[model samples]
Target: MPYTPVNVSLTLTNQQYVALRTVNGTVVLPPGSSGRPDAGGLKGIIVVRQAGNSYLAFERNCPYRPFDACALVSVDRSGLFLRDSCCNSQFNLQGQVIGGPSPFPLRQYSTSLQGSQLNILN
Candidate 1:
């Protein structure tokens, strides 16, 4: 099964939306960093800053068990991949399944960046 999609419109600014709360603490990504924001999505939103102004947004829902409440992905301790503790599924920043039993990658959302604003949709 697939997860439900949501709309997200966020603006990155020092006083607007600068950091994201996480289990580790508030993460402040400069330009090329990955962080989970309290944004829209089935579970939540994980935003990764690529080279230049390119950005990637993904749903935190683990594809292995779409219906499970615990099927959520988080950035691993190494910060190299997103891990779903419920099923031990792992995915890279590009949403590629790299480990565990997951047969599909993480759900990616279309993102459009304009200046300091980012709009995400399914």
Candidate 2:
């Protein structure tokens, strides 16, 4: 499924600069924390910090039913995978389908880290 192009650039200056949404609005995502900010991709972006300075970015749009409004994927509470309530599809952080009826993996964006700048693109 075609999705809105994503090009997100984040500058990490300190431990409290990363923003992530929560029940009480926005909160800080530490240098190693993973969360969905209220921007980027088709249904927003899920940013996951991997080993060391590496990171992974995935589109929140579920591939099962791309046009469905509820096809958006969110990080499951355990922070282990992404799930779509619309079709009950589950995907790993790498965007591979792990459960449910999804036939395709979540769209992954390319990421490049330069100094303190993290750029995600697709």
Off by over 4 Å in 2: 14-38
Q: Put down candidate 2 lDDT per residue, 44-104, tens digits, no spaces.
A: 7677776667677887778897898888788787777779989999987677999999989
Compared with the true structure, the alpha-carbon lDDT of candidate 1 equals: 0.69
- Residues 11-104 of candidate 1 have per-residue lDDT tens digits of 7664544432222222222211123443567667778766566677777778897899898888888877788999999888788999999999
lDDT of each: 0.69, 0.69
Q: Which pairs clash in model 1?
A: none
Q: Give the TM-score (vs. native) of candidate 1.
A: 0.78
Which 10 consecutive positions of candidate 2 have the poorest summed lDDT? 24-33
